[model samples]
Target: MASYHRVLEVFDRSVQDKTLECAYDLDPWDILIDDERWTGKIRLFGFVDIFFLICYSGEERFEKGIIIYKDNDSVRIILERARKNTTEYVVNRDALENEEIPKSYFSFEDDKGGLNYQILGLGHPIGLSTNYDPGSLKQYKIKIRRSDDLVTRKRMQRGLKQHTLIDLMLDVVRLGIITSAELISKVVTMTVAGSATDDLARKYLQVLSGGQPGTPGLSRDRM
Candidate 1:
């Protein structure tokens, strides 16, 4: 498996201004992390997760904490634990409901799904470009199947044994980097909790295209 390090792209003020990514396959860095944790939840509709982190702020060089984007009610335990490490921090959500969810929670927008990664943005971060998103005819079936395949794919890769491919995809979209089959494949393989499986990737692409593999015209093999 390939290893890569990414910066934390904070689109909202709710999150800290530090770069937050996985620690595996990372090169030695000057940044010092005081605390870090990862937790995930599986649901019928979709998955939910929390990553409570605290670190020495690179800008000021002092201890600071970070809160998950979840509602303060849902992340009370994590926030408490994280606070044990630092007094000053950015809690994405705390014991407040009416409180505005920091725009940091989401990234920029994408016309493809009409979903924003951060929140407000002019256009999609990673351009859909000339390529096409598997149309609606196959979107539902493909997303469900693809989401599952993603879970399996993350399991095969090393060091990425915690988050799902969707996490990587979200991060990429937030970063506004290029998103291609090769790029997505390489990065997802590096960060997910499982090993990379070409067969699984193909299965998802095929389903997305609404066509079976080994058939011509529906899907292309390369990015």
Candidate 2:
């Protein structure tokens, strides 16, 4: 067995200000072993979602969270996680640049015939650029897999329904159909009336309602 180590560096910027607010260096994370493959699902912010399945035969390393795939004789199968109701296969740059690599290795099939495991990637605070220069800085990513079954699929569907409800509520507020204060009050009241454990949700509502004082109305223009 070949031992591999990898590292990843992440840069986080505020979408509102477009300013680099934080940076992180994560080290000694997970490694992809030879002949082992995995698949998994990701639920973010209760709305953003992705379902993926992958199979690979390779040895890779992470050093301080920077990504480095050491073995040239590696093959990977990747299913692009779906977002906004779109999904596809993901091709690694290495596979694209190397003529020896065949595109079929990364192909994705919708049929549930193969291994269905969850591969959970390490989560960092930054979004990486697809066109990044690897020579100047190394990039690292992680994947986690779980067995895909009817139960997990149903859970993901439920999450999507809830996310849609929340989005509709926010849209109403954005369109000025309802005041931010009204929305905040409703959320706070419902939360307080039901489960008091969701302090984060309450705080988020407060932030939305307590915008800069004297602002005329809730407008997506300001967001």
Candidate 3:
């Protein structure tokens, strides 16, 4: 398991100016780790450290989903991950059939604790064909609102059980954890480990590419 102390230590050394702009207090660390409500929630996700409780202030302004990672050159990168996965949205034709869509929240739970991320923005509808049920009718993915939203649909079948790979990729991009250009480069280019590649950079890339790293790969237990 990756210790919180070790993560904070890395964060302390990585910051160029030793200051992270946040909506919290002058010392965001104190409020984040010291407070019981926020303790253990802030953790290493993918190649970056996700401060779930803190709203980050970046090039834009205050944004939700703050992630701290390393740049391609191994510099500390801090940015906000957005709630909506993509801007391209398709209108739902089945308005009468669809129920009220509540907000989406991803809960990361493990032995230590749980962090609930309240997904921002009104969700945009997109279709992903599934292998389990392959057909024209299965081409369109079920709407993902709240977990309960699926309870009433399709004879009260299962709801959104997991986040898709595309969803995770968009998350990092939207949050500014990794830029589109950076993402593209990582995907196309072959990465060599050790002195040749940035470990943190590789971790985020690995995560977006749907591979789990040895250390703190979005697993709460590892965190």
Candidate 4:
């Protein structure tokens, strides 16, 4: 499994000064995820932040955090953990000229019939390409599978786990019974617990898990 840090990096870049400042900021701009069909202004329906509580060992670690962006039609997932930067970071280059550096990815389905979609980043920094090479930005495509619901095409599986988390968090928000943080803490703390070498990570996890140092750590079942 890929490290969540890569996903976080994409989101951190996407939310720069030009990008979304908060969930409400998502509606002002029409996101083009390599698609020309769904051009209408998309609204932010859901947003979730997954932190060190869900992190596990033996996976790539990132520093910042992870976030989920759910719009009117689709959801974008990005994660962050602790890891080294060995790969080239995409910058102010023409996205069309450069191949898409898919650092991290996630997908979502609407309530109706669960239409599957694979969203690709058209520009660097995940989002906030308004000032960047808009003309040169890569085309964001939504790969649609009408018949299949849970089954996804190639490279679509990595996003499955993230999507599940997004769905759960969205439901929690809808229910208004518990906050996403409390719910994740209770669920993850019960399933996994380990050590965090990073000072900040440990402290952050402790806060989420109610100041329990060993409450939250990293562990992916398959990885």
lDDT of each: 0.26, 0.26, 0.26, 0.29
- Report the Cα lDDT for residue 56, model 3: 28
True-vs-predicted CA distance for residue 22, candidate 1, Å:
15
TM-score of each: 0.18, 0.20, 0.20, 0.20
Candidate 2 residue lDDT tens string, 1-223: 2111111112111212111111211111221322332222112111211111112124332112122221111111111110111111223446456867533222212224433222222111212322222122212233222224566544433322212337545654755656977887666764468443233222111112123343221111111
Tens digit per residue, CA lDDT, model 1, 1-223: 1100011212111132222332211111311122222122111111122232223323323233222232222122222322222112232335134355421222212223521111110111111122222221110000111112444333222111123457556655655555654576666565474343333233211212224343222121332
Q: How far off is residue 211 in model 1, in Å?
A: 57
Which stretches in model 4 have alpha-carbon errors above 4 Å?
1-7, 13-131, 136-138, 142-223
lDDT of 2 at 48: 18
- Quick one: best lDDT, which candidate? 4
Estimate the lDDT of model 4: 0.29
lDDT (10s digit) by residue, model 3, range 152-173: 3221111112234364456557
Model 2 alpha-carbon drift over 4 Å, by segment = 1-111, 117-133, 136-223
Instruction: List the candidate 3 regions with Cα displacement exceeding 4 Å.
Output: 1-7, 10-23, 26-48, 52-183, 189-198, 201-223
Steric clash pairs (candidate 3): 80-175, 81-175, 82-175
